[model samples]
Target chain A: MTTTLRTRQRFAKAGVLTGLVIGGLFAALPVLWMLSTSLKSNGEVFQNPPQLITESFSFDAYAEILGNGAQLRFFLNSYIVAFAVTVLTLLVAILAGYAFSRFTFPGQKTINAVIVSVQAVPPITLVIPYFGLVVALGLYNTYPGLILTHMVFTLPYAIIMITAYLNTLPKELDESVKVDGGTSWTALWRILVPISVPGLIAVGVYTFMISWNEYLFALTLTRTDDMRTVPIGIQLLMGQHSYEWNQMMAMSILGSIPVLVLFLLFQRRFIGGLTAGAVKA
Target chain B: MTSTTAPDTTAPTQEPVTPDRPRTTLTRRLSPFGYLSPTIVLIVVLMVIPIVMVISYSFRDNVIVQENSVFAGLANYTTVLTDPNFLAALKNTAIFITVSTVAHLILGLAFAMMLNTQLLGGVTKAIFRIVYILPWLFTIAVIAVIWRLLLDPSGVVNYVLQTLGLLQEGVNWLSDPGKALWAVTFVNIWSGYPFFMISLLAGLQGIPNDLYEAAAVDGANPVQRFLNVTLPQLRPVIISMAVLDLIWTSQQFALIWMLTGGGPLNVTEVLSTFTYKQAFSEYEFATASAAAVIVLLLTMVLAFFYVRLQKER
Candidate 1:
């Protein structure tokens, strides 16, 4: 019986290992393919029985993409918009999260409810109205327009995450600051913000990713090549006559690097933030 | 001695300073608003106001080019509801959501279970987790493009399949009307399942081993232990994740737009893409807004349940 049990356990372990390996490959295959395709020349991309790894590896696609000033502009635009959105979101979210976590005030429940409901509203629903609004305000094709629109999604997310993080902290810290005759501002800026650096960083990274990956608003709001973000730029690469598959793949890989780096650097905190935001909320 | 006695005498005087407490209480009552004002103002301008405007636009006969709004009451809604394209989009969205959500949940649970078994070393497991979530981290545009290349008629998928003798010739996955919707649904599942995986893994980790041990002592097998112990523990997480996934997958636009553009005769025309086409492609703002309002109402109902779920937890 002991031997049988050991055999069954070993079989189960092997099954699990097999499943993990398969799942990992399934997850990584498309990305690996993208890398492979990006390194291939155009002719190789279209070759019969497409090569997983081309014999003649070339950086021509990357070079072509980097050589294009418009592509670089898209990258710059994305960086600016993402950075601005992250800062704006973090500032608003920290203040609002601190309030929600610490204070019991009039209309608090209503505001909280509004925030929650707003998050549930699908962003595409507002695209038309926002288009009209932005055009009317003459903010179309502008960075501020995209930044403000991106905040509609990011602010609520950041606020909720920061609030959840703050909820885990003791209230005594604020009270102690109060006892020290320090104002609420001092408590937040001095006591809470310093301690909540990890949470703040998580929210910042989340906001940056959202803005960087945003497409619909970027597509609708920005008209000029200079204002278009990376995603839009990539879409434009697929013109009617010629689909620059290699260069598009190169740009896609380039666009993903910031997010990948952020995830790799803050893997634990980022995952914790995501799981905490989802599971708890 | 005098100093101690003086403070003792002063303590009685300090007790009468309760009059200031009400004023402080008044500030306390208003301060949350002060902190929340920025968020409130931004949401009002960006989200709340736009939502209200969209709803109003749905009631008017508005065109993007014309910029003239004449109240048409429910005419726009009627038009959208009766349109064949709109009906098709609604049906397609339902099918997509049902299939994608189920696929993600099942596959995600399987992946989570495998990961939870600890069959691999710590480093290997960590690498697997990262690999699984890489798709989720990738931008939808990038994901769409990568998948487009893979699913193209002459793409690697067909090449590999043909090499393995699974197909006699390359199949047009994206351009074929019959397969386009399912193709995009597959992509959605690929990128989306990791969300469920991570959440379920977290849920699984939270389950105590003692429960499983107790079930084993009760002569329960592995499947029985899972059904009896794990399912009940994971119920809340599953429900919440499923609900959120429903909203998200329903609103998905970029992937479909990039991969197929609701193409091959609008086989994958979801409500989001439908609305986009009406507004931008056709310049029919009122009709598009009406469709969007319908989508909003559907998601709002789910959101109501989601809120209740959160409160229950």
Candidate 2:
């Protein structure tokens, strides 16, 4: 009876472990394949029973995009736009968030409701209007134009997230700062700003990911190859006559590297930010 | 209206918190506005204005029959419903939503259960979480392209099957009308389940293991234990994710657009992508907007029920 109990316990542990490891590795298969294909030579990309490791790994695909294609320009455009939007959104959301958390005023409830309701509105509804606005403002194909449009989605997200975080802070902190010689602006900048670094970092990374991954606005608004973002630029590699799978995969892997790195560096905060939706009433 | 006198000529006012003087009226009303000014300005210029424009454009004839602006109340909407493409796209979108949501629920629960096991060490567990999460981080366009390569007639799946003598001929997975919808769905499930897995896993972690042990001692087998113990506990997380997944899948476009573009006789044209093509490609803005408005209404209704059910829980 004792031996049977011990064996059952051992089997249960082993069974569970095997299931997890196998399941996890299978889930990882596509991404692993992507990385592998990104390294393979053009000739080897579609080879039957795709090789896990190529005989001669080549940088030719990477070189093709970097050396010839306007991929670098696209990367730069994406970087500039993502950073600009992130900085602007953080500054604005932090202020709005602070006010929403700390203040009581007429229309406060209405404003909060509006912000939450706006999350349901489809972005496709606004594409045409944004297109017209960009054309009219003479900002078509410009980085600022794209950045401004990207904020349509990111700004509300920032406001909601930052406000939620700020709610956890004590009201006494604000009163205490007021009790000091500091003004509201002084307290906000000197005290509140310094303390909200983690929240800000989380919101900043979230906003950056949205901007970086945005495709429709980037694809439609920017016509020139030089003005393309990474998604649009990588997509253009698939041409009218023939698709360049190797180079396309290479560029995609490059495009994905920054986001992957960002997620790795801030996994906990990033996941927390995503799960923020789960908590809303 | 000359009721109150303006406070005596700029006397250096003592601190209000000193309990000596009354608060200034301007400071009270304008302070919140000062904090919210930037957000309001941005919302008006970017969101509100654009939404208004879409509404107006939807009522115009400039999209379908004419290039210049002309008022055609409900004309675009009328034309959209009559169009063959919109109807087909709508069907495809519905199927995608139904298929993907169910797939995510099942796959996610399985993943969460597997990860909830105790034998895995902290490091190996973390690695597994990251691995599962990597696909969800990718743009839909990239996922579409990568899967396009993999699902081609001579792509990886067929190659493996053929090598193992499992099939006589390679299947044209993407080109066939019958298979294209599932093809897109298969990729969506691959890219989607991670988010669900993470959320469900988080919920699973909070469940005490003693319940499972107690059930086991009661002579419950693994299947019975799961049904008796796991399902009841995971109900809230499952329901919430289901609602979110429903809304999200309804709006998903990039993957379908890139993969099939509502093609092979419009087998997979979901709502969002369909609206995009109709408004932009077909230049039938009115009908497209009407279709979008329908989708919006449906989603909002679903969301209302979801919220109510959640509150009840």
Candidate 3:
């Protein structure tokens, strides 16, 4: 009976190992294939018995993409817009989270409910009206237009996460500062903000990812290639040089690097804060 | 302590370190708004006004493309509701979201459960966890491009399947009318399941091992222990993830647009693509606004359930 039980346990372990390997391949194989194809020449892409590691591998695709002025502009635009969005979102979310966490006022419940519900407002719904709004305000094809619009989507989650983070902190921290002749604003900047770095980093990284990946608004609001971000730049790559699969793959890998780096660097805090915001709040 | 707090005396002047005690006056009551002004301004400008504009646009006749659009009471809504293509989009969205959400939940739970097993070392589990999350790190645009490469008729996917004797020949996965919707849905599942997996893994870690031991001591099998303890413990997480997935998957536009362009006879034209085409490609802003509103209402319904689920938890 002991031998039988041990055998069964071994079989179960083997089954699980098999499942993990298959699932890992399912998830990671395409990503590896993308990296491989990015290194290969365009002609090597459709080679019979498609290669995961091409014999003719080179950095020529990455060089072509990086050297091209138009493609480089996409990277620059994405960085500027993503960084700006992250900063602006953290600023606004910190203040709003302070309000929600520390104070009571009329219509607080209503305001909180509205903010939570704001996440549901479909972007397609807003895109039409924003087309008219952006053009009317003379902000079309501009950085501020994208930054402001992206904030609406990012702010709700940030405020929710940051508020939850702040609620765990004692109100006496603020109170003692007030007693020491520090204003609410001073206490916020000096004490609360410093301690909330981990939460803020999580929100900041998620915000950057959203703005970096945004496509519909970028497509609709911007007309010129000068203002287009990476996602749209990829689309244009498909159009401008039909089936330049190597360059397209290279641009995608380059486009994904920032968010990928951020996630790897802050994987634990990111997931913790994300689950709290997304699952809890 | 700076002089900044000297002039800010209120009820807190007497007892400075009180724990959010009731304000003695109205002037003192509205203080938090100082910090909240930026958020309120953004909410009003970005959310409140645009939503109002979209609703009003739905009532008007081709507003964005034309200078003067008249208020046509419920006319655009009627047109969208009656149009066969609109209906087709709605039907496809239902299938896409339903299948994608179910698959995500199942795959998420299975991988999460397996990773939660004590059979593996922490290093092994951590490696698998990162591997599982790999698909989710790429942007949807990159995901679209990668899949397009793989699903090409002569792509690696066909080569493997053909070698395994599973297919007689290569199939055009994206362009084929019979397969486009499924192809797009599969990509979404790939990119989306990790989120559910992460959440469920957290939920699994939260379940105590004592419960499993107790069930085993009672002669309960592995399946019985899972059904009895694991599923009930996880029901809340599953519901929340499913509702959120429905909203996210329903709003997917970039993936479909990039992969198939809702093409091959509109087989994969989900609501987002349908609405986008009406507004941009066809320049029928009126009907698109109406369709957009419908999509909004549908998402609100899902989100309402989500907020309520959070409250319940």
Candidate 4:
């Protein structure tokens, strides 16, 4: 009986270790493939019985992408839109979140319900009307137009997450500020915002990512190539008759770098924000 | 200080009718709205107004060529509902969402369970968690392109399969009509399961070890303990995640658009892509609006139930 129990324990350990290793490799494979392909020459990409690692590393793809003025414009546009959306969304969400968490006011419940329901609406449903609206307002192909539209999705979730995070903070903190002759605005800015830095960072990163990766709105709203974002830029490469696999992969890698760096820097906060936002919602 | 303390205590008792209350009450009534006004204004202009426009557009015969809208009543809806392509898209959406959601749930739960085990060291588990979530962070457009390259006729996936003696010849993954939907579904599952894993992992960590011990003490085996204790604790998370995944997967556009363009004869066309093609490719704005409204209604219904269910919990 002792022998059987020991053997079973050993078997279970081996089973778990094997599962973890295999799952890790499977999860990492696509990203590895992207990095590998980006480093290969065009010839190397089409080699029969494709290799995971190239024999000779090449920087030609990245060099070519860097040389392309159009691609640089796309990157610049993406950065501008993403940054604007992040700043704007954070400002509005923080104020609204503070109000929702700390104050009792008329129409609070109704507004909260609207915010929740807004998140449920499919983004595709509004594309047609948005296209027309942007054109009507003469904001199509402009940064402000895309930034405003991206906020439609980002603001609701940001507010929800910040509110949830604030709910955990002690009300006594705000009361103390009040006791010190500080108004609500001072309480939010001096005490609450400083304490909620992690939550704010999470919200900012989330908003930036959503705007950076947004495809449909970017595709529809921006008719000019110079106004196109990275996702749309990569998509245009796919639309070309001849496939430039290496260049395409390089562009994809470049586009993903900002997000990957952000994640690596704040993996814990991102995961916390995601789960908290989901659970609370 | 003594006088302040006495007033502070009595303030609550006379909160509604103090001599200074009216001004305080007015500020309290107005301040929250002041904080919320910016967000409210933005959502109203960008989201609510657009949706209202979509509803109006759906009722009219609006097209790109005709600048002026003509009242078409339910003609747009009739056209969209009766179109064979739209019907196929609806069916494909259901199939794709069902398959991908189930795959994510099963695989995600399995991964979460593995990550929860003690066999892996802390560093190793952390590294694996990051690896699993890498795909989820990537833009869908990039993911779609990467998979398109990997699943091409002579792509890496086929090459590996051939080397392992699993495939006799390179199969057309994106181009074959019959296989395209499944291919797109596989990509969706690959990119999405991390979400499920993370949420479920959090759920697993929240479950008390005492429950499992109690089950074991009751003569329950490992499998029995999991089913009796683990699964019951995980039910709410699972339902909420499943419903959220259903709404998301049903409206997935970028992956399908980038990979297949809803092509190889539109076999993989879901509602979002269908609406996109109708508006952009065919310039049928009214019909596209109608189709989008239907998709919106479907997701909203699921979301409503999810919210209600969460409230009950």
Ranking by DockQ: 3, 1, 4, 2
C-alpha positional error of residue A77 in candidate 1 after TM-score superposition, expressed in Å: 0.5
Tens-digit lDDT track of model 4 for A193-245: 99999999988898999999998899998998889999999999877737788
Q: Which runs of model 3 end up more than 4 angstroms from their true locations?
A: A1-4, B1-27
Best by DockQ: 3
Model 2 Cα lDDT, one tens digit per residue, A1-281: 99998899899878877877677766777777777887888788788667988986887888887886467987888899999999999998888897788667799988877776566666666676787788889988999899999988888888988888878776656656656654555556677778888888988988898899888889778888899998887677766327777788888888887788888888998787667656453
Candidate 1 residue lDDT tens string, A1-281: 99998898899888888888898989999999999999998778878867777888999999998998989999999999999999999998998998899876677888888887787888779899889999999999999999999999898889889999999898777667766766676677889999999999988998999999999999998898899999998898876328788898999999999999998999899888999889876
Which residue ranges in model 2 land beyond 4 Å of their true spot? B1-22, B63-68, B164-166, B208-225, B309-313
Q: Per-prediction interface RMSD?
A: 6.8, 5.4, 2.1, 4.8
**Steric clash pairs (candidate 1):** none
DockQ of 2: 0.50
Q: What is the TM-score of chain B in candidate 3?
A: 0.93
True-vs-predicted CA distance for residue A53, candidate 2, Å:
1.8
RMSD of 3: 2.6
**Cα RMSDs, all models:** 5.0, 4.3, 2.6, 3.8
TM-score of chain B of 2: 0.85
DockQ-wise, the better of 1 and 4 is 1
lDDT of 3: 0.90
- Residue B205, model 2, lDDT: 82
lDDT of 4 by residue, B148-193 (tens): 9999898989988999999999999999988999999999999999
Looking at candidate 4 chain B, the ten consecutive residues that score lowest on lDDT are B1-10
